[model samples]
Target: MAPKPPTAVTRPPISDSSLVYVPEDVVEGYQERIETGIDWTLIELGAQHHRRKAINREAIPTITFSDGLINKINRGYLKGFLDDTSCINLDQQWEQILPATLWDNEKFATDEGKILFNGINCLTDDLIKLIYKAVVTGNRDTLWSELKMAEVLRVNNEKITELDVGLLEFKKLVSLNLCGNYIMDIEPNFIPPTLRALELQANHISNINSFVESLPHHLIYIGLAKNLLTDESVDAFSRLPFNLTVLDLSDNDIYHLDPLLDALVRLPNLTSLYLVGNPCSVCATYARLILMVLPRLKWLDSRQVLPTDRSLEPYEAHPDDLRSSYFYFTVFRVMSAPQPPKPEKGATTAFHVELELPLLDVERRKFLLYRRYESLTEILAPPEEEEVEKAISTVLRPSTKALSTIKGIDVDEASSNASNVYDHLVTKSSRVINNFTTFESNKIQWAKVMNFQEPTVKIFCPDLFALRNTFRSVITVNLVYSIVYAKSGKTEKKSSHALKMPTEQRVVLASIKCTLRNPDWTQPSQHFHWDDSLGTDEAIHWGDRDLAVIQYTQAPVKVVKGKPEADPATSSRQLPPENLTCHFGFGIETIRAS
Candidate 1:
């Protein structure tokens, strides 16, 4: 059979080289031959042309491999055995040839591979090999010694997902830059203890508590920008390592600074802090409040903190404003009414006394004197001439020229109309005393007075001697009086009927004892007085006057039935007089040393 028609020239076994390298070349040669072929009308050519057209219509024009073939190629590429250039059409291949698992392996499996994949342009294989050798040998001293010459390792924008534990074996690495990566979490102990500075900007980290807890105590600077940090997350820094001096947390999701500020105060050694692009940065008083809260911070948001930004110290009141030295005076009035069958023999009469005092300023020499008795309508009524004279004589003696001058009264005029002038003086003095008392009381109320320096005096009914001894600094004394008169209708009725009146309706009185002191007592006493009844038109006392008036007497006055007579038993004795006076007055002078 013509040797079985040459047995169809059984094809030799395909060699591995031809199978691997001749497929694209042979396809190209056949495609060129078919394109330039003659006889376009022959049935076989027509059939071949129809088949070629049909294949072209059914297949993708840009792709030459079948789906199975592409998948096989991708599998090989993912195994790291094939590159983009090995494909016939790289644009037609899947965009990503390597699987996520293979990518992780290539970037994190070995130190040299990680360095290369991390896009660390400044690193060399020599350092990586040394690190590997040190890690395998478990010799930290050797690693530290080798890494001492190079203290920084930056692998920024590397798209690295995980950190190799072997990398942290370098004990001498001081600064580490892993910025712009896809790292989601940093397990504890991933950072070397010797690192002083670490930068982790633009990453997918949400919580850093683990990293913070494992941080080296010597770390001084850290950058954690463009991360998913919140106010709650910042609380992790409440117990930050004391040596961390610089911190950056810009472009985070922090909404409130209160928690962050609360945390920052715990980092006593942190001098510089950055919080730009956070929500708290929009506050107008953010920087001012920060400087106030963090007094030791030297730099904030990359700007030097000025001293003016700090708040002023608390205000303290001055000693003079406290009204430290002051005095007060009180006045009391006593009224006695006669009852039916009044007080026979040794019965004691009862009088009602009322005392009222107000605040005074002794340093300023200010006092409040009684102007008008509120309970007495008599003081407001017209007064009799004799009663006015008596009141004036009691208040202004003949030797009180200084007081007259102070009262702006002419001695001659005052003597001629002593009652009217004295009435005017009393009214004016009351107004002045009330006004000054109110003003000083308001001042004391408004100011922050010192408690220990305030002097207070309270007195009820006491003996005259005890009252004088109570205030030893008093230099002068004066008793002022205001008289009340019955109404016109009442006076007419009393004159017609001549009926006895109750003491409450017949008498009204008030008194005030003013205590005064002069800081400069060396000056001579000045006195001017006007009293026509005393047989002195105008008198001036050159020195201090001692006027003694009996306040009260316990013994009742005794009256004789007839005239005085001699006693027979004792020849030198004489009987008592017909009448006796219950009141007494004495005037004395004090001689001062030159």
Candidate 2:
């Protein structure tokens, strides 16, 4: 290795021309190893443009960008954001892009554009998917028609303190992102009635009591990371109208652990929680308390929580266990997946998972499983001497190799169960509405009696950990998919529900009574390469038969047009397709969130 080349610090000035890269100072110890090829793998320092290939799926309509979101300033419904996208750099000043005077300039017309909208003349639902309207000022009704039609709005990093952005006027708004602002409190009715994902991360929010009770029942993912949340905000968690699957409180002011723990228990559907930058996370027993307290939590901080993170032992004895216990956790990450025009047809031995949705339909499919117990200590605890003997005598015996029946004194799956809760939110292009799913309480152990990769000296509650107990824990899991109707849609018959009602319709195409019997205690945790159960329903196919994959269709909560009422009343109307199709994969132990 030799260091001979001198490097320059700055690159060519940014311009409309193609981007070019320049070299910078070499990182300390590796200064002389630029040419070294380890195992024939050479390191190349280069830069390339991230080309965003357009999605060919018909579900996502192309979002037409107007002059408003372009480099030139325009006076219209869309205000602020001189750049193409909605983002304010950490150190970006407000005056640089969001010029208040430019939007309110007297030169702009004030015709309200009601006639041009209303989907009759210039606008068709197919042509437009999303419109970026930042904030309201001057005349609140200036963009009234466009605002009413908006399903997803980004008002991030606008230095807004009060929740007085006139967002309440949005009738069909579903996903509202207000991250990187100065909001301190979420006033009553501040959130739109139809919102599902409220992203408020990187704000200055502190008080939550004023708005938790007012949050719409269907709202699921709430991002409040990098804010000023405290222990007081934890109580607001109990008042949320619905279960939250993903919550980000990573960098906040919360200090105590018990009150936060007590509050989180109210949200039984919470599977992923972020608390990295808070003071409480620095505690020695932070991960242990959270993993044990919230049995449903899957992702914590930078890694996925595993069986090793949970312990039935007392906290006082946890420090000693921490010194020895070990497992693997995957780092939290975001990946860009661009596929070919059509999926490659060939498939054989490699276990693969794929989801095919209608173009522009922003839908998410997730599969999750956990023991119903809040504290798995009893089940995973060191087995009692007699119980171990019973398991050895009853389940692990050589004579019982072919015996499939259970004896009278075998294990039981009667641990106090907590319901498995996760909501299915449907989004067509920019629209997102709530769809619900219910699961019966079932005994789901996060880990087996013994792991396959371990020195298998661990004991279990033998009578409880018997193979029979595993069979007894079998429960029904349903995989559902549905469609939600918006306010602007009309049926072919021109029914009354389509006239003015905010009705939603559900179509459950797939519901499988799946008892994802885990592997013979060796239970290949996540490495199962089997797709034995492939249920084909046209475009929708189900595979990965290890644990399961599910597409939740909201149970009909309300009736519409002389039927079981369920309507979201969105502006982008999605009439139920005459021919419905879905693709689902189950048994694979992978939970995906969007």
**Structural similarity to truth (TM-score) of each candidate:** 0.31, 0.33
What's the C-alpha lDDT at position 86 in model 2?
43
lDDT tens readout by residue for model 1, 476-510:
22222222223235665667434322111111122
Count of clashes, each model: 7, 37
What are the C-alpha RMSDs, in order, of all predicted structures?
46.2, 28.7
Please give, for residues 387-501, the per-residue lDDT of candidate 2 as tens digits.
5444453443222112212333211222122111112222222132222122211211121110122211121111111211122122222223222333443463376332232
lDDT of each: 0.42, 0.39
TM-score of 2: 0.33
Question: Clashes in model 1: which pairs?
Answer: 378-484, 400-528, 400-529, 401-527, 401-528, 401-529, 402-528
Model number with the top lDDT: 1
